[model samples]
Every structure is written in C-alpha cells, then in structure tokens.
Target: MKKILFLTFAALLMVVSCKKDPLDQTPDGKITLEEVFTDKDRTEAYLSTAYSRIPDYFWKYSFFAFLAGITDEAKDSDVGNNAGNIASFWNTGSLSLSTNPLEAYGGQGKGISRYVTYWSGIRDCNVFLANIPKASVANEDYRKRFTAEAKVLRSFYYLELIKQFGGMPIVDKPFEVTFDYASLKRPTFQECVNFIVKNCDEAIAEPQFPLRITLETERGRFTKAVAYAIKSQALLYNASPLWNPTNDVAKWTASANASKEAIAALAATGQFALHPNYGNYFLNQSDLSPSPGDKETIFEINEASNGTFSVINSIPSKPGMFKAGSCPSQELVDAYDMQINPIAGGVAGEPAILGYSDADHLQPIINNSGPGPASGYARARPYVGRDPRFYATVWFNGAQYDNINGAIHTIETFQGGADQLIKNPPNRANTHTGYYLRKFIDPRIQSNQPHNSRWKKYRLAEIYLNLAEAENEANGPTAAAYAAVNVVRNRSQMPNLPVGLDKDQFRVRVRRERRVEFAMEEHRFWDVRRWKILDQTDKVVTGMEIIKDPITGAFTYNRFVTERRNAWTDKYLIFPIPLGEASIIPDFDLHQNPGW
Candidate 1:
C-alpha cells in the first residue's frame, strides 16, 4: 500500500534525466510546447519535472548522509577505499571548488555526485510559466494556481543558490539557444533578494492561490504559506551578517516584519501550530500529527519514489541488520541539558550532569544541583532529566530502543557493545562517535511496515525561531521576541530565556536555541556560515570514546578530537561555483569564488 502511494506521488513529480548537452534546447523527439499546452495531462507533467528537481534535504542517493558529516552535528562512518570516502574530507577541511560536496552537480550518482545546479530546473519553470496560458485544463482557477506554484518554486531555487553562492545571475525568462554565456553577470546580493521577494509577491497576488492546502493527498504541494515562509527565510538571510555586514538595524526590521506576516497568515488559516511533541514530530507515527490536521510542518518533500535506502543506512548495523551511517557526534549530544539526576530520589554522590559548563564544555562537570546530599546526579547515567528532544533525536550508549519490533532493547554504544565500533564490522558498520540518529528512524521499519519519515523543509518552530532572532535584533529583546522563542521552548518543556537579558545576551540565547532545536536537520552548517563565525564554531569535531572495565563492569568516558576537522578560513563562507561551469565561461563576470 505504501509502495503504491510512493509511486503515485513520484508520478506527480515526473523525474527527468540530467541534460546531456550544455546548451538548453528541446529534444528531437520531444513534443512542442503548443502540443503540450493543448493537452492538460502533458502540461501538468511538464511542470512536475521542475517539482522533481526541488532540492531534497535527505536524498537517499547521497547515501542518506548529509552536510552534518562536516558540521558539528554528526560524523559519518562510511570509511572505506571506495570512491565515495568523504569521512576524511569532513575532518580535514580540504574541500575545494572542484571537489566540494555542497555544490556537486552533473548527475546523481553514488557518493558526492548527488546535487543539481538547478539552472535546468529554473529554465523548465520559465518555460512552464510562458506556456501555461494555452493549457486547456478546463479549470482556469487550477491553471492560475499552477502558474503561481511554478513562480514560488522558481524563487525557492534561487534562494538555494544565493544561500550557498551569494549573488547570482537573475535569469527570469527563457533565452534562445544562441544566447551568449559570457554576457551573464551575477546581480548584487540586494538585487537577488529583490528578485526573490518580487517573485514571491507575484505568487501571493494570484487570486487562485490558496493560503493553505486542505487536502491530504496534496499535503506537500506548494501554497501561499510556503511562499510566505520562503520570503521570511530569504529576508532573514538578507538581514544576517553575511549580507548585512554593517549591522544594519533596518534589515532586521524588514526581516521581523516578513516573519510576522508569515505568522499572521498561518494563524488566520487556523490550520498551523506547533506540534505538541517535538520529538515525535519527525516520526511517521499518527500520535503527534494525524493526517489532515498536521499543523506543525509548513513544507516537506513528499518522496516521489520507493526503494529509499536512507532509512536502512541509518539503522545501526546490529548482529545481522543494516549498515550504520551518520553517527551523531558527542558535541551534539552534550548540547542536550541533563534534566533529571540519574540517581533516584534526588540523592547526591552521583557525578553531576548539569550539561556543558561555561569553562570547559567538552567535559561534563557542572552540578545542576549545588553540592548536596539530595542531588540525584549520576555520571554513568547522564541521559536522564535531559530535554524530551534529546531522547527523540540521539541514540546514546544507554538509551532504550522500545520503538523497534515489539520488545524493548537498550542501545549499547559502549565499547564492545551491540552498536560499538569493535562489535560491529569495522569496514561498513558501527558508529564513529558511539552515537546514532534516532530522530527519523521509525521503529516499525525493521518490521517491514511502511515508514513515512519525511525531511521537513520548513516548520512553524523555525518561523518562531526566525521571529525571535529578528525581533531581538531589531527591538532589543522585547516581550514579543521572548514570546516567539518561548513558544518553541515551552513545546520542548525547556525553561524560557531568563528575564531581563540584554540584546547581546538574548542574541546568544537565540543562536544556541537554534542549534539545540534543529540539531541534525541540516540547519547548523549554514547558520554558522551566515553568522560569520566559522573561525570559532568550525574549529574541530570531537567524539566520545568509552572504555569498559572488565572486572568492575564500569565505563569510563573520554572526549577526543576527531581527525576530520583540520583547516578552515573565511573563504569557506560561500561555496565556489563548480569548476565545470566556471571554466566554460570566458568572462570575468563568472569567475570562481575567492580562494577557490
């Protein structure tokens, strides 16, 4: 049943092969645009081709591993002699314009060759918009809405480009095959922002475009809310230090207003709100958000095909199970607060796990409860009393795995344990950081049940965070700013930011909140870059090694720097345009990024 559902969705997304020829042109056997517009099905299919090209956050073709490998969020353990070995790249920081995984183009082959340039995707959107008027779809309203969807999607593609490469060429309309490549010059960063905002406005102005889609079958389709979310995100990026380096307060004001507009539009629909359980929101279980009323997720990539290997790859390679991939680093695990003392009845003598200390974060030395006999802290059981999200997101050494099969199993990531480095095969199994991601791995997956793990692109929680950051920057931590961030904190059961925090203090809180909230969701990699703090945050990747005593059966934990984090510079802020594209252009306008 799930397979059929996947197939139907995939059909709507109509996958197209990568363009073999550099110059965009109609294929010899391809039907003309007039013929396509004359038939409703063919026209819709043409638009679906662009939809299929929407950048997938967790594309299974890339081994279901993400940019998290390089960031502090997690470490990948796909260490082998194969062509796809990037474990060293993440730690070494040796990525170049020709070999960076973030801008990988060409085709979706195995390993690092999994991203698209999106130039062809944007071209397809332009063609669709140009030819949509002639479509005899019977419903004028549907055609208008379809055109709006194309426009929003095109703007989103541009957002993806600008976020990574800064200013980019603004190609609004389709050009002739004879158009000169050297004539193209990237517009200013502000110009690119204006282009995206203008496209979003055009989409929203369309009368047929619905603010929110009410149908379950079309849950993942673009809507007015999606456009607003994109606008809010783009504006927020524009307000960031990377773009607004002068600390322009007006940019912050613009970003705050855009975010408020998104929140207002979503609130008016009464169809969107924060999901109560932050942890279960990622899982496909119906408890948190049943179909038709899923209020939290603003935008998601509904997988268009079956046979996704990401789930299996993420599953820990047990005695005879799947290969382990994407090991969450200790750096991420330490970010979760230790809520409860491992000892019962709040008794003392147990080592305190108050979370990372201000002095030395790598070591867990803070005593949440001041030195006392009633404190229930325990060093061996540090997972207790942490945020609810910690359990849902990280699979630590002693964490329980009750979601799998019918019985409960304790995850043993300790030395020589079930998921430990030595226990599993060294070549293709085991975790590099003695941790695994539990957020998106469905428990019923091993039972062969349908798993609906989705990569949520935008959610209300993110908007709340965006509002908090922007509001504080613009208004110096007002009540409204506190309220926005408190919404997310309250949902996760974490305490709100202390009252009377100055603007700079609140700003620091907001940044840390983003890291904890969106840990493994692929947000940190860009957030640090945009904030221009690569020198401080991207210094080193660390992992935890546990040594178990055979006689006493006790475990000793040690934190050590991993080999993947070596060199970094300010030049890594924006990815270099692929050498393939830059080399072909004869003009200085298309030069590679500095220090490429």
Candidate 2:
C-alpha cells in the first residue's frame, strides 16, 4: 500500500510539471507593434514601409503601362492583337470595377493594377504617426523632424488617392480587425484637397524640417520643398478645367501663389537650377558626380543600386536589341518644328502667329531657304534642322545610333531594313510607329552593362511650366510667366515665344511647349485629361509607314491612323472605383463614379 501511494505521488508531480506555462505559450518570432515603435531601428525600418509602397510605374510591376502609348506622344508595340495585354487593355479603355488594376499584376494576369487602392499605405502612415511618439529615439529634434516627414507622406498618399479617384474615405487612423468596411464613404473633392493641404501645412510648420535634402544617404525622402511642390500640384489640379468646371479664378490665383512659393523655397536653397543637358538629366548624369544634390531634380524616384532596364524594353528590335517597345508616333515627330530663319520680330515668310508649315518640314527649295549659312538644313536629311530636343528625343531612319561599346550604326526603320514592319512583322516585339525613343537612353550601356538612371518625379523644368501656366491664367501672360517659359526654351535651344501673342496665342504656345518638353515622360496623358481636351487628342492614334525602294534606296514616309475607337469619353475623365469594393457597399452608385 505504501509503494502504491509513492507511485501516485510521482504521477501527480509529472502532471503538475506538464501543465501549460504562460511563458512557454508565448510566440517566439512574433513582435507587438508597440515593441516595434519603442525600438529606434525597428521604427525607422517601419517608416520605410510607407516609402516602399509608392507607385513605381517605371520599374518591375507596371513597366508596360508606358504612358506614351495611350497619349499622342507615342504608340506601344502592338502588345496584343486581342484584349489580353494589360497595357493594351488600359489603352483601349476596357477598365471595370470588378477587374481593377490596383495591384502590380501586369499583362493579362491577376497581380498588376493601376494603383487605385492605397489604403494599406495610408494605414502604414497612420501607424507610423500614431506610434512615433512612443519611439525611444535619443535625438529629440530628429524625432520631431521625422514626425513632420510622416505627415508629408500621409498627405502625399492622399494626393495620389484623390488624383485618381477624385476623393476617398480619409482614414486618419489604423482600422481595427473588426472595423466595418461597409460604412466607409469617400469624402468631397474639396474636403480631400483641404486635408492634403492641411497635412502639407503641418509638415511645413516643423521648424527643424529642411527645404531640401543635402545628404546623399537620404536622397529620396520627403523634404520641405517636396511638400510645397505637392501642394502646388494639388492646387493646380484643383484649378484645372476638369475639376474646376465653374472657372474659379480664385483657384488659379491660389495655384499660382503656391507654385511661386514652391519655386521661392527651392531657389532659397541655392542648390536647384536647370541642368545644362536636358537629355542627359534623365539618364542620371548627376549620379556620376560625387556630390549629393542634382540641380535639375527636385523630386525623383531614385534607382541607383539595380538601375532601370527600361532601356532594354525600349531598344529597337534589331538583331542585338532587347525589345522594340515605346515607338514614337509620327504625330509627335511632326510636332517638332524645323528651324528656319528666325528674323528679329517673327519668322520670315511664315505668318507672325503660325511658327512653321509642312513646307518647312521639307528641304529648303532655294539656296536661301535650303541648307546653307541661311537655311540651317541639308536636302538629303529630312530629319535635320529640327529642334535640338528632337535630336535628343528621337532616333529616325537615317540617324546614327551610337552603341558605346562598338561602331555606330545608322538606325534603319525603312522597308526591308532593320526595325520596320516590312522586315519585321507587327507584334509586341516590333515597332508599330517606325520610330524608337532616344530619350532616357544611356549610350554607354552595352550588352552586358546595366543602366542606372533617375526617373524624375518632379523637376525644375516642370515647376517652371506650371508657374507659366498658372500665372498666364491668373494674370494673362505676365512678364513673370514669359520669363518662366523662356527659362525652359533657352535651355532646349528653342526660340522664345514670338513677342506679341494674345492670351489665346500664348496658351497655345504653352500647351505645345509642354507637349514637346515633357514627351514620353508620362505627362501628356494626364495633361489632356485635366485640360478637358482628351476628346480632341485621343480621337485617333497615328503611325508612320515607311516604304523604302530597294533599287533607289529612297524612303517614303506616309502617316496612317493605326488605332481607332475613341478611347476618350465622359466616363474616363476619372477612373471608376474598384467594383469589388463598390458591390459590397450599400447604394453602390453613391460610392462609385457614374456608369461604373
């Protein structure tokens, strides 16, 4: 009986030992957000999550949505004959709420989207802001600066959301797991803009925050200048015809003032200026320097480490080329004005108002008009004597494309030659427009080498154009506006606007200037939409059909309408809210844009 009692006591002891301990039950690898915020390193890494979510159209995810294709600027290689390619689908206006492209699922897949949803990014920003005070960063000033920067980021995400969807539910706090999604309602357009402005103001109010970043280590972070720039852009969009249908002159004045303020802030830094080479600027020539800052880039998506492979996608479809995507349109080519006699008051022979004609596009008829000291162009070369930017931006049939590693070869976009429909059939890898983009190309890039180029999100030139547009609208082409535009013109070796242009004439000049200066940089598509001129611009897309004679070796260029079916419509002014979200909401029409 004593032995049995001892065995029972041992069994009871084993049971007590095996009982669940609270410490043992805790998860090993998991960490609470509070723990994340309290640690300096963890908190900083957490802040980077917000930065990482910025829409990267140039890189891995949405490379095919080259904005040039959908606009008059250029045409993408016929990526799809059917409605399978995402870029083609986007260009064709086949978007639906159920099949929204908010993710990075490119092509006909399920991952790439057009960046319409940013709630997760917004949540990240809110989390950072709410928990930052709890972080134990020893540098008190830095903590304050970081807080202000977080505010700017929050504002930026809102700006992105508003620009795409007009307005969104302004969720300033992180939603709990049990939070009701159905109750969320999008704010008013004006309310959304005000919220963004308020965020900018909060960031600007921080005395410790700097106007520009001088440290190379912190290149892509938000700055006081960037905040102001965002404000300027948001205000400008608010004043634009699409959003401001009532023609509110006050909004224009506000936008002009905001832009001027941004310029003043940038100029105060004494580091910002126009880079001498417009073409080389986008190629990240500034990175070649050991210095921290670039004069041209106010804000940019920096890709210094891996470098961008956009060159590979954009290269002509020759034997050694990667893919003949991003083909420049004949319409964009024709927009480049051929240099003629720039007489003192106005161009000679042409009307004072109209700059150049089709005859100007041809070789000079006479010795005076033709290639000489007087005419500036040669007869054999049809592409010569155009704007200096034209040579930098386009690679035509006869132009020598420098392959830095080997001998320079003439780009053959003629019939039976390299990179033409006659020699290469029309497909995703072939050029539909018989022209290739030369802008943002690194001539030094060889087969094995990679290109590390900067993609400008905002720059001095764009700000100058913004200032000119806003000032022109507010004060009718004031001296400040003229000087602002002249800054961009002189940089590109183009002539200044003719001396006596009326408001309408000045407006036309400004619009054309914007088109040529910002071509293939993703501005034309949005510019048309905001200007309420998409109907005119998006009516038809054109391409150049080059017929080359085998015996004579002569080239005949004919322009033809390549893609029809007006992609522009009233519904497209603002993209529809993702249908997945709309269907779940009560009174779906109230939550969605008109007609899905």
RMSD of 1: 7.3
Tell me the tens digit of each residue's lDDT in model 2 across 1-596: 22212332111111111113221111243656666677888788878876766665543324444567667777666445434444566665666665543252344222134343255566668778877886877588879888888888888877877777677767776544334455667677778888888889888889988777776687778888778878888888888898888989898888888878878877546667788877777787344233444677767875443333534445454335555667787667766655554433324212111222332222213223432224333334547567777788887888777763477877777766766643234666556777788887766676545677666877778878888888888889888789888889889777677666677767877887788888888778778878988766775666667787888977776656666544678677777776654554444447677556
Per-residue lDDT of model 1, residues 1-596, tens digit only: 12222332122222232233332224445655556678888888888877867755654434545567677777666644223645445445657766864433222332233224365567678778877877767599989999999999988888887887777778776654334555567577789888889989889889899877666666667888789888889989999998998989998998898888888888546768888778778775222223444687778875433434434445454323455667777767766654444556663222234345432246665554564333344456556677677788887877777655466777777787866754233445667777777777765455334567777888888888999999999999999899998888888877666687899978877887788889878789889888988766666656677887999988887776553455458888887766555654443224566667
Query: What local lDDT score does residue 373 receive in model 1, on the 0 to 100 scale?
Result: 34
Give the C-alpha miss distance for residue 515 in model 2, angstroms.
1.6
Candidate 2 Cα deviation (angstroms), residue 1:
65
Show how many residue pairs clash in every candidate, following the order shown: 8, 9
Candidate 2: residue 298 Cα off by (Å): 1.8
Give the range of the ten consecutive residues with the poorest summed lDDT in model 2.
9-18
